[model samples]
Target chain A: DAGITQSPRHKVTETGTPVTLRCHQTENHRYMYWYRQDPGHGLRLIHYSYGVKDTDKGEVSDGYSVSRSKTEDFLLTLESATSSQTSVYFCAISESNQGREQYFGPGTRLTVT
Target chain B: AQTVTQSQPEMSVQEAETVTLSCTYDTSESDYYLFWYKQPPSRQMILVIRQEAYKQQNATENRFSVNFQKAAKSFSLKISDSQLGDAAMYFCAYRSARNQGGKLIFGQGTELSVKP
Candidate 1:
């Protein structure tokens, strides 16, 4: 409820297909992050952005890419999606400075067939 | 690399009872923060409590409190008089204070069930 929204709350795509998930925030936070949640493996970071056009790969950045063109919009793309990529994705935003409280939006559940 | 560990996978507590969830972290940085997040069936992540490493006093919010032992690298959440609404997947997270940017290392999570 931190003015964050994830588009395509539920998606189904086939293997080898391209998919892009969008995270939009209204808080104008400077930091945005994308994460994937799987059973037995909490939430694993995929990519994060500190500012417009500034992005960094996370621990599980392989096979995934992200772009932040505006303060509110952060995009995550899975090129040639694989079945292993099927999982629930979450978007988080943090205000500048301490960035202590990272408010999360409702997750997006994606399925790769 | 920093790591958060939640040794308990599942826990159940009767309504109005007290429950404690254990979490331990491994980090070299002396300045950091710990947090407890709750995710219910709705799949929304909710922040329950937070503790700063530099703060010696435990943090409490309503019926939720944290026993943060910085020297022991242990952080535990105690829910008093648990309610059915408290049932959720609880996650322990660690964030380093060295970097101002947002990055959280999360534990696997502990599913807490509040029985009627």
Candidate 2:
């Protein structure tokens, strides 16, 4: 509803394969974030970008990487997917300030066998 | 590090009745922000209400309001005239006020069921 779209909404892949999830926003928000949601763990931030080519790691950044080439596109890549990495990924966008409400994308459900 | 806690894993309320969901947070900073987000079965996160730490008055949005106790570090959401559509998983979140692009820390979430 926030003009945010996540491609490959659902994907099932075998272990040790490379996977990439795409998040595109029409709002051109300055801040973008990638998060994973699991049972019992509501949501864990993986990586975030402040601007084009400016990124930072979050609490759960291990084994995952993110790149922001433009203001509206942020990509999350899994170098070698593992069973443990299977989870629902969400992309969020916000303005350039703190405490602002974040708008979330529908989400991508990735399953690794 | 800031942390949010939602003690109730599940809650229920009758339609047109009132319900309250509890949330507590731990943070060293005196200034921050608290938020409540609702995620329906659709899995889309929606902002239900928000409270600024510096403001003493609780935030009220339509039938939704918050009981923010800054000293106690407790922020609870009260929904009045609950509707069947209110059934969803509610998450409490916290963000730092000092930093730009501050990432949010969320609670485990409380699933609210609206009974008919």
Candidate 3:
């Protein structure tokens, strides 16, 4: 309900192929995040952006890169998809006044074969 | 490094009954925030409740409440008169007070099943 949207709800790709996931928010929030969910690991942060062209690596940023060229759009790119990268990815946005209650998009289920 | 821990991998509660989910976090910052998010079968993360560390009073929404013990470094969620719709995966999350980017550290989740 936070006006967040993620493109390509589902994707399947072969190993060594490149994949990109996009997140767009209509609320124009300044904070955007990318997270991946896997069994035994609830959700791990992959990357986040605070402003246009301002990004930072998260705990599991290895093999993943993100870019925020505009306030409402953030993109996550996997240079070479690997089987280990198969998981459900979520995009979230938050307003500074909300104090960390992030509004999440539905999610993207990616499978790498 | 701040970390959130949810020990219960799965839980079950009867309709109209009460249930409590345990969550513990380790953080060096005195001022921070804790949150409980519910992810249904649809896998969409929804915010259920939130607690601020600086506040001594526990936070409560309609049927959901939290037992925030700062001394014990514990933040547990309690659902009273649980309903069937409560069935979902519950996650505990932590965020620093000094940060404004809304970066969260999540715990391993607890899958809750509500029975009739």
lDDT of 2 by residue, B30-111 (tens): 9888999999999999999989999999999999999999999999999999999999999999988886467889999999
Please give, for residues B1-116, the per-residue lDDT of candidate 1 as tens digits: 99999999999999999999999999988998899999999999999999989999999999999999998999999999999999999999988887635689999999999999
Model 2 over residues A23-70: C-alpha lDDT tens digits?
999998999999999988888899999999999999899999999999
Q: What is the lDDT of residue A34 in candidate 2?
A: 95
Index of the highest-DockQ prediction: 2
Q: What are the models' TM-scores?
A: 0.98, 0.98, 0.98
True-structure lDDT of candidate 3:
0.93
| Residues forming the 10-long window of minimal summed lDDT in candidate 3 chain B | B94-103
Model 1: how far is A99 from its true place, Å?
A: 4.8
lDDT of 3 by residue, B1-116 (tens): 98989999999999999999999999888989999999989888999999999899999999999999998999999999999889999999998888646789999999999999
TM-score of chain A of each: 0.97, 0.98, 0.97
